[model samples]
Target: MFVRIVKMSFEPSNIDTFLKNFEIKKNDIRNFEGCRFLELYRDKNTTNIFFTYSYWDTEEALDAYRHSDLFKGIWAQTKPLFNDKPQAWSVDKLESLT
Candidate 1:
């Protein structure tokens, strides 16, 4: 499996807007081709910080999602809400307890 994690810090006043946008797209994203899992996480100490942790069947599967129109539209709306450049990583599992 390919794992992707995106860490984002939202503009304080734009956090709600970001959440609303994310809520609207989350389901479609989960249902996208080759998606195995999807989740959203928040930083306990930083209310405006969030992360998306997802699993794809392969790097190519993730690339397909990134190239889709759904991604283009959602990302256009999402990009301006960031307080900082987002951090992301694509990796394969070394080991997992579960």
Candidate 2:
């Protein structure tokens, strides 16, 4: 499985708006093809900092989602709220303790 993590830092005032958008779109995103899991996390010490954790069947699957209309819409709405360039990483799981 491919594990993807995206760390995003939003302008302080835009954090609530971003979370609202995510709350509205989370289900749709999670239902996308090859999306095995999806979640959002916030830094306890920094409310404007967030991360998205997800799993995909493969890199191709993730790329497909990235190009989907769902992503285009959500991303376009969210992009302007960034306080800095987002960081993303993809990992291949060697083993899982669980």
Per-model TM-score versus the true fold: 0.95, 0.95
lDDT of 2 at 75: 93
Tens digits of per-residue lDDT, candidate 1, 38-92, equal 9999999999999999999989999999999999999999999998999999988
lDDT of 2 by residue, 1-98 (tens): 88999999999999889989999999999999999999899999998999999999989999999999999999999999999999999988788896
Each model's C-alpha lDDT? Answer: 0.95, 0.95
**Candidate 2 backbone clash number:** 0
Off by over 4 Å in 2: none
Q: Ten consecutive residues with minimal summed lDDT in candidate 1? A: 89-98
